[model samples]
Target: MPHTRRDHAVVLGASMAGLLAARVLSESFGRVTVVERDALPVDVLATGSRHRRGVPQSRHVHVLLARGASILEDLFPGFVAEAEVAGARTTDALGQVRLLLSGQRLLQTDIGLRSLLCGRPLLENLVRARVRALDGVRFLERHDIVGLTATPDGRRVTGVRIHADGGEQETALDADLVLDATGRASRAPVWLHDLGHGRPTVDTVQVGLAYATRTYRLPQGAMGKDQLILNNATPENQRAAVLAEQENGLARLTLAGMLGDRPPLDPKAFDAFAASLHFPDIFEAIRDAEPLDDPVGFQYPANVRHRYERMRSFPDGFLVLGDAVSAFNPVYGQGMTSAAMQAEAMRAVLADDRDARNGKPLTWRRYFQAIAKAVNPPWQISAGGDLAFPDVRGRRTPAVRMINAYLPKVHAAAAHDVDMSVAFIRVGSLMDRPESLLRPDIIFRVLRGPGRRHPRG
Candidate 1:
């Protein structure tokens, strides 16, 4: 067992990132407190699956990448089994889910990857429950974060100030460390500026992404044996759709478009958008399905990355993780998984703090550096994909250009090559680095192009 290095640690936000941070912090801190502005579900097992205001994308389909599931299992043992017990669907990643990239259908095969299909609420609740069960961990739900509380010299963060929802006065909570896990709209940069520290460099890729999502109850044998269908958009189409099987016999279909093209909320127009996807699988499955809810829309302006590691100076006992550091295009389904990976990075950094025995606080600089390494690959993958569209605004460096040009060929070859398909999926799931896709053997297959048809299960 590791010795407790800090008396208390405070985590901002109660989302996946915040919950994961609290879980990891409990090991090194004597007490961990998570503060959130929204009211959390009291009985996660009973009403946890219902959507909340904070997570606007709750209505959309969410997939737990294989790499992320493995990390969660490591952090909280039997996480996969527990999620299954909570009505989440587990299926062979390649064999059961249809993947279409750049208008090419990847051949089905048992790639040894697992896909966990469940509503975002259910997944967050499960994680929140695990964090809540930890000793000396507590939640301060329905509270608004006021600001950071620093030492006299402003060299270290002492804690945070927060106001209870509907309360008149703000309360100060003292801690040895403060971690900001607030999502895309994080105010950490502004806070740092106020504290007389230079803001981190910001990188933005304007994707102008929009989504329209709806729920339905499909008829018996609607998709035959398939559990999920993802038809990604290409520059030629500029539209995408995903129909995923969720718990409670529900199917959630989310239609997406890029570059100011928005999917409609009108029932007929929504179907028309799905029908116009590269493939008709999603449209065909939901054509006669029973409507469960009205379509909802979400717009994402850009993918933003705060280059905190490049900042010359940062206060001690203060750190940022998750979407607060980088927000990616949702079409890639990398947000939650990226947060999980960042949490794992935080865990590793905390565990490696040899100075903890001397009562030294965590090295925030090291933590940020570790998470930057963790976020780089996924950010590049998603950003590179967005840049493939002629309309997206960003610097298309030679490296990005080369990779973008090669991806189409890779996708084409993966249509019939099982090894090629598995390799692509592994990289997409973050199981392996993107460089693995450039191996000599994989390159050879790409050069040869797709082969004759193969039987698909």
Candidate 2:
């Protein structure tokens, strides 16, 4: 149990980040309230897994990296078991998943890591149910957030102003701390400006990414032993696709293109895009599968990062986490894992603050600094990947150029070297730091150059 340090904490947004934040806040606050604009599903079990309008990308494929899954299990015991019982699929991270990066297929090897595959809605609903069961946590559904309420000095946030979704009456909810987990569409910058504070420094990488997704029910033997197949886009070929087995015995096929090359939603055109991927497995499996839904499209313009730690002045009682702080390119599947890492950092910082038992309020400075550290690695990875394409607009330093050049060789070597494959998988799964990939031993293997190709079974 954590030491109680505050009376109330309010969290904006009830998505993954908000739910995770509220779960941690409940340990130290007497009351935790989550404000969300959407009316979430009442009975997740009865509803099964369905998409909600609040999350536009819910129809797309979502991957819970090994690190994120570990954190979720720690936060909510039996989470993996519960999810599996609910039809979620799990596979040996590197063994049962096919990964084609830079047009090179990685040799399959069991690295003892677990990959959890399910729709975004199912993952969120599982976590939301756990958060709802906490002693001091409550949710305010169908509420529209208006703005922040701060002290007259503008040095501290006192609460938040919100109104019912369909009603005009505004209400102020007071709290000792306010956390923004509203994700990519967060309005924190404008709210901060309204409080007489300067907005945080912004970093943007314009990739102009787009996605088209559809659901299918494939034959039992279609995929054989493989659970997920990911064909990443390379500079030479700016198209990617993923086919993952999801809950309810269904599969999702999402096609992605970068730099204004949008995947078509038309059925024939969608299949053509899938067929154009680096591998033919996705197209082959879905070509004869039962179509469950028409293709849905979503667009992401740029990777945005708000450097709050660099800001000279910030309110004392407010903090931002998750996509509100940094929205990464989703192609790398780092968003949810990064959010989990941030939530863990917040937990550690709050524990230290509680242990000090100081008379002063919680230090927003220390929290934001910790968050920056957590966001740095993933940001570098996703940003570096986006910048790999010459058409993408970003400043590529010498280091980025060197790493991008070396990564292809590494991918090529992994085709025959199991050690190289494991190392790359570990880093990609957020289980290890990116620096591990540059170690002397891994570099030796990578520099060995391309080896004989291992044909896929």
Candidate 3:
């Protein structure tokens, strides 16, 4: 067990990242306060699945990657079982999800990997409820963060100023440590600038991706056999679609387009768009299905990464986690998992800080370095995959070029090879690194590709 540090810590945002941060902080701090602008639902389990105002993309389909589920379970014991009891559907990763990678369907196999499919709001509610139940954790919802409070030298952060919902005056809350987990809209950079510190440089990959989604009610056992169907957008076809089976005989379908190609909101147009994709399974399944809601759309211009690790200096008692540090392409489904991994990294660094006494703090540079390592695999996979599309602009080195070239072949081989498919799923689910997919044996199989077939329209 690690030694306890600080009397109090404040986590900005009640999102997944913030909740995870608060969970970890509870272990080391006497008191941990989570401040959020949005009001949490009173009875999330009874309320069922619904989108939160703060998370615009929650209306779409979301699947918790295997690695992410493990991390969440580590933070909250029996998380998967509890979430399953709350309406999450569990299935073997490859056995249930019909994955089309680079336009080729992976062969069905029992990869032994598992995934929990459900609505984003339900998952967040579960995690939030667990975090709120912790001994040292408390929530201050319906409050807006004004800015970070800092010392005269601007070298260390002391606390934050917040405006409560419908309140005239802002309140000050002090803490020994502060974590910024406000996600993509985070104003941490602006707050740092206000404190006379330079904001971290940002790296971006512009894909101009847009997607639309809607929920549908299906007859019991109508989905039959396959719980999920996905066709990832490839260079040959820069459009993708995914249909995931949720609890209560409902399914969520998401259609993605690239380089200014947006999915329409009309139901007929949405069905037509799904049909237009390389895969027909999604359209076939949902064409005659009952539409529960109108199609909703979301746009992502680019995947952004704040290079905090590259910055030479950082204020004490201040750190950024989750989308505030790096926001990945949503198509990859790495956000929550990546945030959980970052929290794990923070836990490790905090645990190692024996010299955190005498007013000294854990070094942000070292922590950011650890985070950069954790973010690299997913970033390379998602951003590199996006860069495969000719219209997306980014620097591609020889290794990236080589990987992109071999990826199509890999997908082709996975169509017929169960072992190859398992390797691909493992890497995609963040359970293993990209290197696992590039082993000599897998490379040979990809190169040989005995059962390879032509592309399907």
Candidate 4:
């Protein structure tokens, strides 16, 4: 380990994952500093003072999966209560949502993953405000973490040095442990290589996906009742998706497509994009509503994972989490959930290290592998689903190929079969493992039930 358990710990990012990691580190480390290259939003909520930098997909719709939401609430009690009090709408399982695929309504399942909705900034603001109140955790906004400083033996990481206002001074604020909570722009791999440790292995699943989102006022009587409507495109058609509804009565809508199918950046084209969905209700309802912001777009080329867990060796007292390690496309909306699990897994590791020397415990390498176990399932559920498309080229496993082959039927049956819908939605929401979708009953229903030609809106 680097510093004693009482030394300072530094976090490398301040986004949702970074914030969660900082919150947890405060319990063990004496002082925790989070460094971010992008200037954080002063108001973080409505103002979005920090625009379009590191998280370009912030403009796109962000959904906090049910399991992820539960994890966040566990880490910070009364968080869901806080979000509800603030104006975010907590939606019920596939019940409140009107899912349409291939022009028909996905039936309401008895059990579905429940989640909360709001602009990313709004959610971030609530969490950030809570984190800011912590006594030991601190923030260093607009600063860059150049690299990690290690002990003379080069066997452990002691702290981090940041580049600041026209001066370069290495501050040795040692850490009991260091967590790299930085987002996708993380440089942990490069830093590790510089210290003689090899870079983490890499894994990637790519799809030429894009997003275009705009905000609007929910029409009278239409604010809280409407469900998310998605017109998913299978391999047969390259185009896909539309999500429109409430987040604090302030309606937000997005149009997305895969491969070469791109949504328009203009208001007129945006309307056409919505109307083109399997359902016309959502598009018809908002096509004429006032546009609050200019149409914005973000292109996501691939889903990449840094196989840090598979690495041969890692320095003591150093660890990485969240997008810094495995980043998924925002489309699947697994970011926060995966980070929550990472933080939880780390907490368990820290709790188990009884005989830990000074700062960090000795089981640093073990903890990283444990995190991989927690991350892999969700990664498979997400990127695997994305690459199932015709335009998404990859060498897929037989099971992946099987699941991908039958998903359309599962989706089609879900719209008409109650039991199947419940099973599918629960798995999709991360409330359960993907294998749950393979239950005998679900498979029987998907194959034997009346399959709808289209989903209901």
Candidate 5:
């Protein structure tokens, strides 16, 4: 069936969610304007070396999980291949990465889980190039969204008022739809209140997560056996770290701390922090590596979710997705993947019903409902996992308690059993639902215990 085409659509922010949303919206709108407050990096296509100050976390490590990789490929054909050519490294998630969970190291094995490792700037550049080239998609850089223009009665959003960076003029760009992908600092709630609509309910989990990352040039073939190393903080130990292989023989080591604990910026202190991890592989490999940059730190105060699905009334022609909708604890590395999932949800909801394109109020509600469904699992994994840390304040339901209690068993079993490891990775990657961990077979294996014992230092 031929669907109706809209005149124009606007996406706020050019981050992952905004880029993905523009890609999806291009199919149904004649023109899609992406409004970004930060100036677009000039070398995004040529070098993939530039970063926008708006995205401070881009300085740290980021991974495209199995599902996000698949989605990006679907949205932009040859994405992985192009990324690889641009120096992004691909390795089987379970094969090349040393994973330690709950103090137990996963036995080295290939389980067919693939991950795309690269700096966030490089990945963003690739996606930005692809999206910029899409017909009818225009990048409106240096524009900040001030508020939405609405119908006289405030029943529908008509357009958005945007101010050019450092300019006195605020202009209105009319559109059939307005999507807020501006991330955690989204002003949609305030805009809604000013427009007389009730604000969406918000849920928050305080994590107080902090990270310090440094890039280094490894000695040739020094990171021989493994491409990545990860050690997660347990309830007993609130420190974590990951050393990820990046492009051009460069690697990034990100040390993480919780509840106000922070990795030091001094090189010696950072090395000591790495040495203090429960697992020493990261420190042993990077202690003598050539440093390319100083250790930089970023802080995440809490994980937030705007419960738009439960809103009694929302304006038509308005929608919010991506980190604007939910920002998870970065320790889980779920932000990019969650944004991709929300973009995918937008695509699904947009494609499934042609009638929904009529600019009706129900259409936005339906899309928010779908986004809520997509967010549930990752929310459960991140928010639920955060509860495991006693310092993190949250409501721990019976289900949360049960899952937390049983997860250590799963981690212990995964140290040696391939099936258990696979199950855990699958859930972590969002390829499978969290309930998959509760299946009888997995439960039986976890209770049966890890198959062997290995000495620890």
Candidate 6:
């Protein structure tokens, strides 16, 4: 084994990514500490708790991508099984989900990938419980991390400064490594600059998407079937409707639109907006479904990516992962998948018995290089879609335009053909890179598609 064994790893956030990272760290390090800003749930029930102030999008609908469910299952075995026992529906992706892609129904196939349907809070609660079971980790609740505590030479990050119950505390908790598993709103970049490290280059692609979602009580007979009715936005009509049944017998309907096309939060406008989409299954589903609460809205501006891998200087014993490194559009459903991959990447690096991974404090370059391998694929995966719309602005090169042209045809082919369908969904889910869809077989099929995909109303 390589010589570097961390005494502890300090994680900034305790949500999905935070808890997963803490679990991974516990395996490699003797002890792990997660500093979370919000108070964790006292009762382990998967009830729809009010949104935590730390996670602004908790109120929005969050479903695990197929790859994310697989990763979570491997990282914490029987987690999905437990969720299944608790009422999460584990249904085949292609067979169960009714997806209208670009305007057509994606062809059904036995993709072997299953998605776990549950709200964001319930998924977080299950993961938090799993992480807490590890003896090597401890969560310091209500301890908000303010800044990084670094040593002189600016070569290493030893700990973090927090605002805890102790009040304006400057106490230093020593660690062999400090992990920034903090989500999108992390202060890592600013803290890096404060420690004499140059600022990491950032890439932003704004989609300007917004959503208005409200929960409804599902009809009892409807509980067993994987209830996902998705209507995609056509170029002319820039709105989509997504309806899914959660584990708690609650159905969530999120009306999503881009540019200036936002669904109003008023209950009166909800049905009207839902009816305006390409398909109206979701609207029909919720028409008689019992409304649990008034509509809640979430506005996301862009996908932010920090090119830490290309940065010139980074301290040892310090690395940023998850949303602090990249945050994608929730509309694409990639955050948790990318975060799981990031944690798996970290674990693999820790498992490697070589200096190429992490040794005596990885240099800023070496550290981010490892992370870039994980982040770049998902970045391109998300950005490619956002840049598709003429209204969404970004650097659209010839290759991008070429991709835009090809993607529609590929997507069209996927609507009916089985192999192409599974391949496209695999790439879209971030289990594989976008290039994975470019196999010769898929390309030829997209160029000349087999007709007769399953028709959607």
Each prediction's TM-score versus the true structure = 0.97, 0.97, 0.95, 0.90, 0.95, 0.93
lDDT per residue (tens digit) for residues 1-457 in model 3: 1123488899999989999999998988899999999988857677668667888888888888888899998999999999888889987888888887787778876666778899898889889888978998999999999999888998888899999999999989998888999999999888888788888899889999898999998666655677888889987778898889887768999999999999999888888899998877788888788998999999999999998898876788888999999998888888888998899988888877744554455587888988898888888888887778878987788888888888888888888777788888899889999988788988988888665442211
Q: C-alpha displacement of 122 in model 3, angstroms?
A: 0.8
Error of 4 at 275 (Å): 2.8
Distance (Å) between predicted and true CA of 138, model 1?
0.3
lDDT of 6 by residue, 97-139 (tens): 7777777667665567888777777778878888988998998
Q: What stretches of model 6 exceed 4 Å from their correct place?
A: 1-5, 46-50, 165-168, 219-226, 353-364, 452-457
Off by over 4 Å in 4: 1-6, 41-52, 102-104, 109-113, 165-173, 221-224, 354-362, 451-457
Clashes of 4: 13
User: What lDDT would candidate 2 get against the real structure?
Assistant: 0.88
lDDT value, residue 355 of candidate 4: 50
Model 4 lDDT, residue 24, Cα: 81
lDDT of 5 by residue, 1-457 (tens): 1123378899999999999999998987889999999888756546565668889999899988888998999999999999999999987877787887799888666767678999999999999999989999999999888899999888788899999888889999988888999999999999888778889999898989989999999877665678888899999888999889988879999999999999999999999999999987888889779999999999999989999988887788889989999999887788889899988988887777655555553366788889999999899999999999987988899999999999988888888787787789889889999999999988988999756553211
Considering only N, C-alpha and C atoms within 3 Å, which residue pairs clash in candidate 2? none
Q: Model 2, poorest ten-residue lDDT window?
A: 448-457
lDDT by residue for model 1 (164-270), tens: 98999988998888899989989999888878787999999999999999999999888878888889989999999888898888889999999999999999999
lDDT of 4 at 247: 60
Return whichever of 2 and 4 wins on lDDT: 2
| lDDT for each candidate structure | 0.88, 0.88, 0.85, 0.75, 0.87, 0.78
